[model samples]
Target: MIKHNVISVVLGGGKGSRLYPLTHQRSKPAVPIAGKYRLVDIPISNCLNSGYNRIFVLTQYNSASLNSHIKNTYNFSVFSKGFVEILAAEQTNEGERWYQGTADAVRHLQRYLQHHDYEHLLILSGDQLYQIDFQEMIEAHIETGAEISVATIPVNAKDATSFGILKSDEAGNITSFIEKPNSSLLPPWESEVNDEMKAVGRVYLASMGIYVFNKSILTQILEESEGVDFGKELLPEAIGRYKIHSYQYPGYWTDIGNIDSFFEANIGLTDDIPQFNLFDRNTIFSRARMLPPSKVSGTTLDNVVIADGCIVAAERIERSVIGIRSRIGVGSVIKTTYMMGSDFYQTLHEIEDARANGFPLVGVGENCYIENAILDKSCCIGDNVRITGGAHLADGDFDTHAIRDGIVVVKKRAILPAGTVIG
Candidate 1:
C-alpha cells in the first residue's frame, strides 16, 4: 500500500492568533495534545497510516520546534524513500515578503515541489483532530476522473455558516462553492446527505480543508492565479473550470480553532468512549521518549489519562489529563484539568534551592485545588493554591494566566505563589 505516486503537504497555519498563548512560542502544529503528542501529529499520522510517506510541511510562523520534532521523529529506513521535511518561508528572489495565505504559501514553494516525482498532491491542515484514510478519497478521485477532489463533511445549517459549503450533483460532482455564507442565503446551498445525517439536521456539505489534486492541474492553477487564499479566492473560482468531486466523510471531525475547542478536545480524551479514538489500529507516531513508568500513591483517580514519567500523591484526580514528568504533591485535588508536564525533570537540589528562596517549585505543591484549568509546561503551583475557573470569571489576560470562555490557562513557565486563589 505504499503510495509512491502521492505526496502530502501539510499547511502549518498562520500566526494562530485565536490560540494565542499556546501558539505564542511555537507554531500551530507544534502545540501539544493528548498529554504527549503534538497537534501536527494528527495530519502526519493520517498520511503515514494511509501509506503515503513523502511529506513536506509548509510553515512560516515559529517553525523551529515543529521542524525539530519532525526531523527527530520521522526517519525512514535507508532502503526506503520516505521522508518528512519542513519548508519554511524564506526571502526568495521572486518574493521577499512572507506568505500571505494558504494558496500563496503553496504557490511560493512550487519550485521546490518540482523536484519531487508525484502524480497527485494531498493538502492537509495542521490544526484539526480527525482520523481519515486519504487513500479512499484518492481512489474516488481517480475513479470519477476528477481533476480536483475535496474532502467534505455534513454539518448542520448553524455550523455550515462558519465553513466553506459546497453543492454537489447526484453524481458527486461539485457544482458550486461558497465561503462562510450568511444564514439568509443558506436556502439554496443545502446538499443531499444520508438519512442519518439528514435526521440530525446535517444536510450541508462543508469543506474539511483536505484536498486531492492532480499535479498538472494544481501547477496550472497556481501559475495562473494570484489569489492569496484557497477558500477565499481559489477554490470558488475553480469549481466550474475543473472536474471537482466531493468525497463525503462521515466520521468524527473537530476543528481545534481556539482555546475553548482545544481545551475540550483534550479533556474529551477522559471519556469512556471518546469520539476521536487514540487506541485504535492507526498509531499516532511521536518522539519516543525514554522515561520510566508513572507512579501514583494514595490517589483516587476517575476517568483520567496520564502519560509516562509521572509521580502523583494527590487526594483525588477526576476527569483530567496529566502529561509527562508531572508531579503532584500530597492532598491536592485536581478536577477537569490538563497539566502539560515539564520538559525536563528538576533534581532534588534545584527543587530545594527554589523552595529555600521562597519560590514555587516545578509542578503542583501540597493541598492545592485546581479545576477547569490548563497548566502549561513547567508551571509551579505553590501550596494552598486554588484555581476554580467557570463562567463567574470574565475573559482577560494577565501576567501569569488568561481566562477565556470560563477556562483558566496558566501561561508556560508561570509561577503561582503559595496561598494564591483564583476564580
Candidate 2:
C-alpha cells in the first residue's frame, strides 16, 4: 500500500446541464440519488470511510438546495476541526468569471489549498455513484511515487474516443492518452455491459475523474496550466513530465452524467448483482438513524428494498427502492423507481418546514400509479394520476409541468393536484 497524507476536495460546481428538469433548480451533484440520498453523498461518504475528514465542496449553479442539504443532513459540527465547506465561484485572484472548466475550478482555489499541509490532494466529482476504497488507491500512489495516479478502469478502444484513453505499459505506467476517440479503434478487453455509452467499456484505464495529486505538483500544474482542465490540459503535461500511473478500480463505478445513464443507474441498483455497495457497512455513507420501525399498513410489496421508518398503505410497489420515513398512500402503484425523502423528518406532521425552501413532502398520491418512470426525491402527486408513456410530448405544451426526454420529469417539491394525468 502506498502511504501518503491526503485531503479530498470534491468538484461539484457544475450546472449539471444534462440532468435537466431535475437539475433545473439544483446542482448536479446535489441531485438526489438512491431515493433518499444526494449524488454528492457517495463521494463525501467515501472520504469519511477512507479516513479523510477535511473536505471542500465546490458549487456554481443552483446551489441553494445543495447547500441546504449539506447544512441540514451532513451535520459534521460534532468534529471541530474536521469540516465540510462549500466554495462558490467568486472574484478570485484569477478573475471574476464563473468556473469555465474543471481545471479552472481548482485553479481558483489554489490559495485555499496552499494553507493545508497535506502530502496529496485528491479530486473527485460529486455526481457519480460508486463505492471506492480510496485508501487503497492512496497506498498505491505513495508506493509508486508517481506524480499523479489516476483511478482507472479498462475500456474498449471503440469507446475510448470519448475519454482520455490510455496506452499504459505492463507495469501500469501510462504511455499515451486520447480524449473521447471514435469507437472504431476499440480495445479487446471484455467490454462492460452496454459499451455504446459515452464512457462505457471504453475504460482502458480512463480517468474516473478520481485523481491523487501530489499537493506540490498540483500547485505547479495549476500555474503552468493557465486554462487547463483535468481532461484537456494538466493531464497531458503530467504524463509527459511526471511518472503518471494508473490504478485499476476492480470495483463497481458509474458516472451518471446524463438522463438515460441516470435512469439506468437507479434501475441498476435493483439488480441481483448491484454494481453499487449500499450494503457495505464499513463505508461512510451516512443514513439517518431512525428509531421507529417501518409501517406497511396495507401495502403489497414484492422484490423491493424499503428502508426504515416507511409507511406503505395499500400501495403496490415492485422492484423499487424506498427511503426512510416516506409515505406511500393506499391504492397507489409504484414500480421500478426510487422514492426517498429529503426532509429527514419522521413524519409529515413532524416536518416544521414541509416545503423546506419550496421542496415538497415526499409522498405518492393516494391511488396514483406509475410505470417505467421516475419520481425525483421530495416530489408529491395527487390521487388517480397515471404516468404511462408519452414519447411525443413537447416541453411548453401538452404535458405542462416540465418535459425531459419527451417524458415529463417532475422537479422536487412541486405538487401535482388530484386527477392530474401526467403522461
TM-scores for all candidates: the values are 0.98, 0.85
Question: How does residue 351 of candidate 2 score in lDDT?
Answer: 43
Evaluated against the true structure, the overall lDDT of model 2 is 0.72
Would you give me the overall lDDT of model 1? 0.92
Residue-level lDDT tens digits of model 2 in 54-117: 8889888888888887776666666445777789888865588988878888888777887877
lDDT against the true structure, each candidate: 0.92, 0.72
What tens-digit string does per-residue lDDT give for candidate 1 at 375-409? 99899999999999998999999988999899999
Name the TM-score of candidate 2.
0.85
Q: Which stretches of candidate 2 lie over 4 Å from their true place?
A: 1-3, 73-80, 156-161, 184-203, 287-292, 342-362, 389-408
Which candidate's TM-score is highest? 1
What is the Cα-based lDDT of residue 390 in candidate 2?
48
